[model samples]
Target: MTKERIGHPPHPFDPARDPVHKRSKQGDSVGGAVVIVGGGYSGAMLAARLAERGVASALIDRGGDFGRGVAYATLFEGHLLNVRSARMSAVDGDPGHFVRWLETHRPDHADPDGFAPRRVFGDYVQHRLATVDAACPGLITRITGTVAAIGTDAVVLEDGRRLKARAVVLATGNPAPRTAPAGASERVIADPWAPGALERIGAEDDVLIIGTGLTMVDMLLMLEGRGWRGRATALSRRGLMPRAHGPRPDVPAPLEAGLLEGPLSGRLALARTVAGREGWRSLMETLRPLTADAWQAADPAIRGRIVRHLRPWWDVHRHRIAGSIAGALERLKADDRLTMTAGRVVAIRPGAASVSLDWTPRHGPARPALTADWLIDCSGPGHDPARDGLTGPLLASGRARMDALRLGLDLDDQGRVLDAEGRADDRLFVLGPPARAAFWETIAVPDIRKRIEAVAAALQ
Candidate 1:
């Protein structure tokens, strides 16, 4: 357990005492005793939970925008929450918490099944944090800066300042996607979600997007909202698009005893049988409760095969998009404004005003090179910590190690980060996307809220 250091009455955070503003000697301590790195959804929620438990903490974010994070920081109204509002409660053990908050805060979108804009959800998160802080003043000290390293009992900032912390929670969510191919030049938008990434492109320029998952769908929606007249081509290996949301079953479909206890192939076969009878949506929702156990129980070789060959299929079926969004995509394809191609990009050649790529079709021989005014890589967030700048310091110092599959950080079953020596560090813990390797179903709201509760219990 973490050393008990936050058992005193809370005080509001004073900017004058913030360690970043004033230089600190080797051991000068300041701010909340417990520090949380990353003010995004996971970090903010954890801080709120801790504060409610009377544990003061310092919440730090490089972007300085608390609660929004990458997922909810969007100004685009078209980017809606993937999950329905009824299940998006910020409070754990209270399923209707978000719905009640929505009725009071955003009545226009108060329907229990309606999908709220992500920005509104961001507002809700910020409001919850503020409300908790009001009740427990001085507990959450919000700091805006990039974290350089985490010491035994302090957090080092890039500006050479340090905040003394008895414990640290690395809630740095999704890292930016991997860099594009070498010499892809300025036409390649490596990360579409970056602020103003698509602003420079001409309205009529043709686009070639990599990947056909939800990120690709988001790009299309953003482009359509921008009133762009450009045509787009979404390229992927299997060209399978995300399934649309459907009516959830009143009762979860039952699985045979020990159905998921067998090999990966056997489990997939069972999934097919269930989908054929109860529909794909029912099959996916039913599997949610057991996915992590199934993932853990599988042999390492089977896990690798699942990732390489069946991941896209699993993702599309499990992470369904809103019906309206799916309809928009269908209309775009029907209008000849969008194209979906199944292929693999072989090489890229940069051009002065555009980018050219040579790719092989999934079924045919090498095809003619495709050229586009801009090549946007819509591949999802990168998970490797070693390549991430913020998480790199931990890897360099041997305080953290990557999982065997390189999905995310290596973590114990309790969500504590594992060091290079394969021992869990009590002073450090991980939550949300960074813990994906250990918890397969952790990225969604329902799963994340439960994780926050568990981590809060462990911390206290």
Candidate 2:
């Protein structure tokens, strides 16, 4: 079969002359329409919302997994959502949307508070997209291919096909783990999420994971599913595991308006003070409504300080795991099968059978060299555009610039991509984790859904 180049030939729609609900003929394609560059959760939600508003758009992704980004693409039964089913809706105002979908589709596993498998969540997202596509017909076009560059008026695919669009949305999701350590590519697995990433390991092979965050938790779960009996070592700067989520309280803590106005230390101190009265979980929940505002209101220096000093602590408390996963982790620890260390890797040497690693503890002297059959870089995605494929051209062409933190692309409060000259582009928009530079909480589903709703409203 001949390969069809993946990209929607844009659909024609004139806001002034065309009926709002008019549906294009099947296979009819137009130009200068909305084109979203990623078909993951962000892009899927945005497209669905736009379709709900009688708008037409094209969704492009390399993997062609319209709703399942890297996060939910995992088929592992043991990998579950960190958030409960009740709060994992794709729509902004529909808190129970996902739970309702689960009831209709997978009733046996549809507990509102239970953490559903990531695959189930992926199914829910795909179902939403399918529902929208059926209702809107040709309004949502699915394109499967890599977007190589973002031109001023079009997106250039890897195969040199340029699809013109009036507006472009960069919902490209998270980056892969930093490139494997030099000369250790064969022994190091840079992306734990990649297909077949763990297929080469034997059941008893020693494994070293580079981070003690959610990714490491995922790796551990996958290993256990494979019946791995070898030792696993997780190393991080703080060696902190994500806290487990308990039953959410019936009532939330009172809002503290003053929390965002003070110095970083003062704000943290206030949070601690409140945590003393209401538990830490409640304090964090209370801060949820105000997180974006508080993050934006803080001085850049203060934000930097928070990232440098309190990030690890914040991460553990902010991104909690499921109780079941936590129990499994504890069991592994109890069985002396897992080790968590706080240290810095001094050097890495590749060997025929294993990789040699030299690490120094955070506070202690250097330890003896260690060896691992496989070293997985689970430190999460790096945010540098210069090092990324799609964004690199945008940066080189001055079409985009890095944020002050260099954690993501520079964007305005309205989610417009800013040029190298620091000017926001009217027709170019961005959502998802890359917008974290402007909205610190953009990585989560709730935040992404809100952003998608806003962007869709604005485009409409």
Candidate 3:
């Protein structure tokens, strides 16, 4: 089975090594079951597993129902997951679970591992929910409401309702992208996640994008689909692009033979570890479980250093490009329709028809002006805010502290939320992308699935 991408050396599970950090469970209990918040992939997977074990759970979401988090809430028929289906599984051990599910459901399927549309994945999650629900009638429940407050062992709903359970799981997904620097005119489009945003802008309108990460990649593909013929500019801190993943290899891992113990020299250190061990893909596959250890072992001073100096490169290395999507981006580059500039947007001034961005180059005083008919903020997901999502309100009120790295909420080694006094909340558990500060590579599906499963077991 395929593992999550961690890019560290591997190790077989050793109970003696105690990879799992311990938690203090002596404080409080709401009795027999737990309530899962944020019903996306993480919530769905955990709910399925918990219900399978005969433990009842309340799967709650404020969105458009089950499986429709930020990623699947769109009305588009063709929005796709960046990663292929083969690697996207709700179960931690069953790597091909999603692929097999799609095969059984969609008989006319042409590509299983290929990037399928968002609706297809959403349907699969819905099917799993139905399957799990049918297996355990009255054992699992779904609630559609926004959570206004999370107490010790209870969640207060916005509608003045309360849900009390033995434990709580926060599987809240990534937040939406922040809006672009606003101008007086409509030339600047802030919320790209809004429905029909890409469709409203025509192919002939010149556009400017804020960031150069995956969101930019999605927009680039969308533009290609719309036959956008006008010039585009992607401006970011580095203007660095993402790297593409290689072919999958099934070689048995040789990295599990104790090669990960030292201060690795460079890229060659990685090469030597994987020597005669596995293909590049195989090596990466084995390293998936050890990245957190590596991240924790990494110097804290250097941690911020890495974020400042090497974040762009790290993002490209971790978040690879799909082959077909890469081909589309290549065509855009070849046609001279897309240009990536490394600079800072000092200000956005809107004219009668177009928006002009005042720019300053890296270490150069020659500040030039760049203009676009329309501007979209592709700067990636939001962090803490006052919205009704996951981390916003708690952070705003100091119920929980943000990580020193500013990565998400402060969490313990076992994924317990650390409150304002730096103590783990006994009744609360946290998982998903925002946990990245504590568990560096925990955002992806595979790693997140394992964490959810492990935490579920711990709760049991």
Which candidate wins on lDDT? 2
Off by over 4 Å in 1: 1-32, 179-184, 247-251
lDDT of 3 at 294: 67
For residues 68-94, what per-residue lDDT tens digits would candidate 2 score against the true structure? Answer: 999889989899988878889887765
> Each candidate's lDDT (Cα)?
0.80, 0.81, 0.70
CA shift of 325, model 2, Å: 0.4
**Which runs of model 2 end up more than 4 angstroms from their true locations?**
1-30, 248-250
List, residue by residue over 389-410, the lDDT tens digit for candidate 1: 7568888899888887878788
Q: Which stretches of candidate 3 lie above 4 Å from their native place?
A: 1-33, 73-78, 108-113, 179-185, 247-286, 363-365, 385-398
Error of 1 at 36 (Å): 1.3
Which wins on TM-score, candidate 2 or candidate 3?
2
The residue pairs in collision within model 1 are 11-138, 12-138
The estimated TM-scores of all candidates read 0.90, 0.92, 0.82
Best by TM-score: 2
